[model samples]
Target: MTGNTNSIENAGDPPRRDQSEPRRVHITRGLVDVLLELAEENEPSEMNVVLDATPASSFDATFDLDPETPILTHFYLPSAGQSVRKVFGVDLGTPAGRGRARFLTHPQGPFKLTERDDFAAVVLLAVPPWDDDTLGAFDRSGRKLELVVVDAEPPVEEL
Candidate 1:
């Protein structure tokens, strides 16, 4: 018991963590870098600018695309619902993808992320069954694009 306290050999008993788990989590820092890189290559605009967001519950937003930027989409948490999901957005003059937006925390949402918008962060989503999608640059004309997916098969109408 006279060895270094930080010794890996000791490997003190692990502490128990809270039972809470994230429903819809954001991309990790490592993945974020890769995402940005992909976004950069397609850079929807000539300006070197990064966008910041504070996503809200039951909310939707649009991002203006630049010519040289790239974008992607994806979905996780297989236990959610079985909806014919789809991602919608401007097609940057190239029909690489489409623009569709839906709530991530719906009773019929694509992922089992109900009651947990706090941990949700925006990232590229995948198409239905594929569970993820990605796009490069915004549509031409600088029009804002929205991300759309089906939370439920029939799509729960937002009140």
Candidate 2:
């Protein structure tokens, strides 16, 4: 079974996982809050985040199927005086169908929620209806949102 490590194999073909099998990537309470907050602000026309679970956690989760379905997860936030933080799981749908967006950050020091910059907040909104009028809302907002548009497709890996 020896082969070139870097050669272009049918690596694109990802083996499927049994639906009955339980998944390991459980969405934490924090993740749910982030997703919900973003969704409320965006109000996407369709789906939200897309999670592609695969047997190979590293590089075998991109295989496509008929209209991908999204897995929903919820979170709770306690510090902000809120009872819970709600965030959706993942969207396995197609580009033409549902959309996806995400905000991710890291906990530092003692995992205190008070620290504003303790987490690197990133929001990736996948809008299937990517139109000027739709996207313009964010672009023409009076509030300042720090965003950097990367020209190249950023590397896809679960952190």
lDDT of each: 0.29, 0.29
* Global lDDT of model 2: 0.29
- Tens-digit lDDT track for model 1 on 1-159? 576655676577575445353222222233334334543443332211222222322223333333222222222222223242323432232213322222221223233222333221232322122223432112222222344332212112346
Q: Write the per-residue lDDT of candidate 2 for residues 1-159, one digit (tens) a residue.
A: 367544457467575677455322222233344454554455532322332221222223342322232222322221232223233433223233322223322212211122232121222222323321122101111222323221222125455
Q: Candidate 1 has what TM-score?
A: 0.17
- Separately for all candidates shown, the number of backbone clashes (residues 3 or more apart, or on different chains) is 45, 16
Model 2 worst lDDT window (10 residues): 132-141
Candidate 2 global TM-score: 0.20
Cα misplacement distance, residue 114 of candidate 1 (Å): 22
Cα shift from native, residue 124, model 1 (Å):
4.5
**Per-prediction TM-score to the true structure, in the order listed:** 0.17, 0.20
Which candidate's TM-score is highest?
2
Question: Looking at candidate 1, what is the lDDT of residue 112?
Answer: 27
